[model samples]
Target: MISQNTIDTVFETARVEEVIGDFVNLKRAGSNFKGLSPFSDERSPSFMVSPVKGIWKDFSTGKGGNSVKFLMEHSQFTYPEAIRYLARKYNIEIEETEQTDAEKAITDVRESMYLVSEFAKKYFHNVLLNTDEGQAIGYSYFKERGFTNETIKKFELGYSPETWDALTKEALGQGYKLEFLQSTGLTIPKEDRPFDRFKGRVMFPIQSMSGRVLGFGGRILTNDKKAAKYLNSPESELYHKSKVLYGIFQAKQSIAKQDNCFLVEGYTDVIQFNQAGIENVVASSGTALTPDQIRLVNRLTKNITVLFDGDAAGLRASIRGIDLILEEGMNVRVCTFPDGDDPDSFARKTPYEDLVKYLEENAKDFIQFKASLLMDEAKNDPIKKADLIRDMVTSISKIPDRIQREIYVQECARIMDISEQVLVSTLAQLIQKDIAEAGKKQKQEQKPFEVHRNQKPKYTGYSGGDPEDPRNGPPEDYPGEPGYPEQQQVEKIDILYHLERKVIEILLLYGDKTEVFEDVFLRNNGEGEIETVTEKKEYKVFQRIYLSLQEDEVELSNTLFRDIFTGLIAFYHQNEKFSLEQYLMRLQPEFAQEVTDILMEDEKVTLHDWEGQNIFSKGKSESISQYVTETIMSMRWFLVDKIIEELKSSIVSNPKEDNMELLMMVMDYSKLINSFSRKLGRVMSRYHT
Candidate 1:
């Protein structure tokens, strides 16, 4: 078990911005930081980090938390694992208590796989450096490719012996479970015996963004006609090739610092570039570019420059991937080496400055690059030229930004010597077709989630036995009845949901602030005249809100809002000042995330400026009192409306001789609702029928 003292030290020392900034490209926004969401594919900057509060919130996914929580959510690490990761990043010395069975079990199957992979990486590195076979074969091959000892060691490059079962024996003898080895794809299991999966191959360890070993990519030395040249670790709990980018662990900081990423095709390309003094580079590891991988880099930077070798055929084959980057709403440029070199060989031959200069000078925007490379092929053939123009239009259509699309269309028209109008028209058609197809796909996907009641509601006679009573018969279209639309019910629930959440948001943001409140009462001591007296009193914002809620006996209907409300009330009474980090530490991950969403909702307003709009920035310290009162009155109004609804429902379900009692109660609620609307600065007709 991790000692509580060590956990405390980690929590206090680990800065949320520093820890999260390693993986995300965070820029200063007012007092906080903002960046593109690491969790979603969004072009806008919606992810925010508050350094003072030591918390980060992703508005796109609605996930927010502290340093450890960010690691757990972003990397999918368990609680203890996330704590340990933060501990390592900050160099905090961990103090562990006595070993317990429960603590051992916390390193789950996924972690076991990670542990096994880490062990394999170190063991293979050891073999490559120390063993005779590895030295003469694997070490020699890497050295021949111009990999220095420092580069090899930094990347944890390793080698597996030619002999079968060599790694398996060592791993088993060390008490690492064979099941985990097999699961991580380090050892291929057989009924007869297990053997090393990368035997006689040089190893390349694939790491996640936090520098944890997720998998490996091995390159075989000998050109065995039957065997594949490259073999990657299969999908496992800890390793997902599509979502993991090679060398991201080492390149993330440099990528964020440079605000651009160099995407190559192989592991060697990344290593050689790093060795050549370029650190912001990663490889797709010989797989097709995926949206997940693109998003991985999208978090760190918005620009990706694809590097290709001199092989024209190979470069042409990779041109399609440029569209993938564009589809992710990223700026893509292309760079290619001379006829004799790839990134590895070119960097090896050139000096550092020259290498950097060449890359900068040669990188061309996507439209220019695609046109120049493909124009040669369509050379003077009228049929081929027309097809080439159509292809450019199609590629332009994939870009999500309309302004960018227009710019690229103009670029394409100028380069291809075609009319801009023709290209724009073609692009429009392609986009329309895509929209139509997407609409059809959405309809197909929504069908399963549509209302699925298997039977009709049973109709019963009203208490007065009136057959014509509306409550006794189903309407032409009502919720839960066949053919009834689901949208009305959804809208009704959403109204109350927003109202409840607004209360919780107010309490969280302004509860600790002290404000003056006003009270009015009739002053009469059997004097000549009974006059109204106004009294002013100072109370903490929470006290005023609580008193108002207590007066009505209002309880939040949503489970999350109720928890937040109760917790906030208890916390405010117990402590003088509210500490978001301290309060969040005491809640579960789900509750903590929701509470963070409420607290950080105000931060969203500052990231964007509104010159003439007064819709947001309502919870600033200067305006806390009025904002609190207005929010409370709004909730009271909603609750009064609900009470009226319930009373009306009660009257409809049962017939009364006079109905005077319910009618009077509804009338009182109506008057209260009008009063609330007046105080809230809204007309009565706006909130009341």
Candidate 2:
């Protein structure tokens, strides 16, 4: 177990913005920062981080919590692991009591996988740097490709030795299980033997977006004509090639800062570009570009510059990727190397400024590039020329943004010697075809359900029934009444709204208020009523809340009440004058959720965001606080009134007023109602100004 002292230190030192910034490209959005959610594939910025409140919320996923929670959710780290991550990031030393062997044996599977992968990375890196065979093969290969020592180490390039059981044996000797090694694909198991998977090949570690090693890509050096040129780790619990973009872990920050990503085809291309000072570059690792990969880059920047080799096959194979990028609503530009060179060779030959200038001058939009590449083949061949035109139009039609598609269509027409009107008409037909396909797909998705034979059409909760008719659920009794759905709903809404307003009021108005409630005497009890205050229902609620607040407890059991309650807890802890405007500025999503929950529950709420004139008035801190107190007191009085009414009905039914217990209950109910009414009046008068 982690000590309380460690948890507190982690919370105090780990800033939400600092922790999240490592993975996300956050841009200032008003007082908070907003970015694409790392938790989901989104094009727009819906992930919000508030440093003041020390919490983050992904509006798309509805996941919001403090820094520790974000790390746990994003990295799949356990609580202790999250704490350790923050401790390492902030340079805090952790001191823990020794654990027993039995305790150490109980490791989480996810963490175990991470540990095995990390161990493999270190072992491979050690082989490349320190072993003679590794230096002669792996190090020499990287050096021959013009990579400097610093660049090699920065990328953690390595070699796996050519021994059958070298790694498995070493790992087992070091207390790691062979099962975990095989699970991570670090070791290949034969019928009765096991061997290192990447033996005799140079290594490239593939990392997660958060920079943890997940798998590897290995390149074989021998000229065995039948041997494959490159090999990659199989899909494991930690690595999915379809979702992983090589070098993203290193390039994400630069991509965000520059607001662009440079896409290349291979590992060397990524390294060479970075070495040439173009830091925001990643490789697709020879796989066809996927929507998942594009969305990953899209999270950092909307602009992508695809760097391709000058070879014809490479260009033809990559054309499909351009449409995919466009479909994702990304702005893509294509740049090819010289006929004899690729990104790796060209980056080494040209100066950084000259290379950047070359890309800027040569990069063409996808539509124009496709047209220019295919135009020569179609020249003077009417059928082929018409096909080329249709192809360009089809590509243009894939763009999701209408204005962008129109602009591309205009450019395509000019390049292909076709009329803009003709291109536009063709695009319209393609769009209609797409819509029809989509509708057909929707119908196919709905085919599994059995149609109801004699169903009465459902009425939504908004359809208010006749109030005078018992047939429509007993006249829809108001809140605090017996046997009414609306009454329970109203009670819930009143409690939430009032509690929030009271907390906010305490935070904004009386943050520094030191007024204490004095002990009051009770004539019937002889002793002062204050001594028995601990047992009173209202006082018990206050006491529970007060102790929780003092313990730095912030999370409210009710999701609807959490944000306001948390804000109140923070306010008490800060010891500074609180500002409602600033608080709202920071936690807009939480506040919005709370407001929506309240409004959606009750058919009639006492206070809206505005007053009777539809003007913004009651939402002010003072007005809201007064309204909350009124609502709570009114609810209490209403409950007492219902009790009194029930007792009177019982007495009338009996005809003889001889029930002493019933008489006491009625008196108590009346006294409570009168007290609550007086308190409600005083609270209203307090806000009458």
* Candidate number of the best lDDT: 1
| lDDT tens per residue, model 1, 37-147 | 887667889999999878889988788988888887676566888889888888998898876677566556777888898899999999999999889998999999899
Error of 2 at 552 (Å): 33
Runs off by more than 4 Å, candidate 1: 1-65, 69-81, 87-108, 190-192, 235-238, 440-510, 513-516, 520-533, 546-580, 586-689
Instruction: Give the candidate number with the greatest TM-score.
Output: 1
Q: At residue 588, what lDDT does model 1 achieve?
A: 67
Q: How much is the lDDT of residue 395 in candidate 2?
A: 84
Query: Roughly what TM-score does model 2 have, to 2 decimal places?
Result: 0.60
lDDT of 2: 0.71
Can you write out model 2's per-residue Cα lDDT over 1-689, one digit (the tens) per residue?
56657666777777889999998899875556778888666687777777766666776766667666677566656557788889899988776656676765554555687898888888888999999999888899998999999998888988888887888888889889888899889888887888888888899999877778989999999987876788999998888898999998778867865778999989999999999999889999999999999998987778999988889766876888988998888899888888989999999999999998999999987776787788767778999999988888888888876768878887877787678998889999998898788896755754542234232111112222232222222122223234434545445445554654455444444344432231222234554221212121222223334553454333333444566666555655663555533443344343544432332222112122223556543433445445444644554455557568668767876976687889888886676666666667877897676
**TM-score of model 1 vs. true structure:** 0.65
Work out candidate 1's RMSD over C-alphas.
11.6
